[model samples]
Target: MLTSSTFSYAIGLILQSIAARRTITSNSIERGLVIRLATDRCYAWGLAAQVAGFLLAFYARETLPVYLVQAAACAAVGVAAVMGAVAFGWRVTRAEAAVLAVLTVALVLLAGAAEPSRVTAVPPATGWVLTALLASCLALAPAAWRARGAVPLAGLAGAAFAVLAVASRPLPALDVTALPLQPLAWLTLAAAAVGQILLAAALQRGSTTSAGSAMDAVTMVAASAAGLALVGDRIADGRTAWLVVGLILVVAGVLAMARVGTVVGEPIRHTDNDVADQPITQGNAR
Candidate 1:
């Protein structure tokens, strides 16, 4: 029985992978088809890394509870950030590291306090879920078109993300094959992919932290609730309730740290100097 927190980290990593692919895809046109192919290759490697990490996480889960797994996932961000620095020569300053450290600690403590064994039943396939996801995408189009900032775009994308998260984790009560082939599932999937692309572009345009915050919030809440409501996840006891609280705190901590980073790393500058100025205004002050 995995808790909501566990799912949150898992989904966060999934979104992070999507964001990474978006980063590569951004230059698809300028880099040409060959670059696109290369980007796909990189995407494959990232997927592989995730798979390996998950396998390790599963093993870690055996000795530790779900919270530990979530904490471990938080730790992986530090690894990823360092990889970004070492492999690509992307510099990481003390402030960024500090923020990430605080996030890691919060997640670790949350995980330590969380309860274990909260399993949801696998949902049966249903047409309505698909329909709802499709409707969400259609609704988001105009909003996306009109979106002026990263936040709005992230919000729109978050809407689509909510659809996918809810649709993917279908209610446990339903039958798989009995369920109609959902156009909504496909649509929501497409929306999620595209939303991520838009999210990455917005992040690049301004604040990665802000974009990350939006992505994290939208995806986590959408997925967790879907798991709970439709799939039969329960917080029926003290341990489970405490675990849920820890997860929320963990999520809040990560987003808070990200927001702090956004504020400290002002003016949207990508250089060391951007963060060198201390916790000034968020992104290239207007």
Candidate 2:
């Protein structure tokens, strides 16, 4: 389920990136508008993919430890990075490749060290925590919007996603008939939507490598903490040290991926009138 979700997310991102590039290059006014429409459509598809991924992930969290599920999902970053390199022509340095490889190993270790999640009914306090998290993300959105860099926006998005992950812990089993009746389910959906919007905005504002890394790192830490505190998730017997080491490596690798520069083929060229709206930046190039 996690693997399938990651593939869906990668495909969605690639489509959205392609559409964004098309929107920038259309020669005729009508053609530009059409391209813009297509870009929006692509974004919708991306959103759908993300929503589906989150649902599957949330459902899995019921049985799997949070760190394990999250680690598996965060692997989507690698998929996105590779797609960006191949589809958008972003060049990955050898160092970036090395870091990604380390990240993969760390995920494996984290998963191996995770004990099964404690399955229990949702506690009342869980609702309050989810509300607070949602409110915090809302408060940060405006500030992230005003920031010049993608890190703030990406971080906010990651945090919002963490909230969704936490909320998902108590979610009633996914049922077409009963899910809509649950308030927590609605809250989870709202949080996912907000996270996706913020992430997309962040990606538009800067390099995917940077934005994706920030999102993944923040989500891993935040979600793991929430899982431990709110859902009583624990490491496998005598595996605390392993979990800690794996987490450190995961964070280090994510930061390394963020710092590595990406070089895309045929730089996105913008017309004079479109210059201010041009989203690509040289900062993304090493």
Clashes of each: 11, 0
lDDT of 2 at 178: 73
Q: Which ten residues in a row have the lowest lDDT in candidate 1?
A: 22-31
Report, for every candidate in turn, its global Cα lDDT versus the true structure.
0.46, 0.69
Model 2 C-alpha RMSD to native? 5.7
Taking the tens digit of each residue's C-alpha lDDT, what string does model 2 give over 73-111? 666666766766776666777987887798789878987
**1-286 per-residue lDDT for model 1 (tens digits):** 2333333333443334332323322212222423343355433554354445544544443334433444444444344444445543445767667756665655655555544443323334533664565466557645554554456556555556555544443322235453355454465456555554544444433444565566555555554555456544344345555556656755675566454443213211234322232322223311
For candidate 1, give the lDDT: 0.46
For TM-score, the strongest prediction is 2
Q: Candidate 1 — which residues are off by over 4 angstroms?
A: 1-79, 109-134, 170-194, 260-286
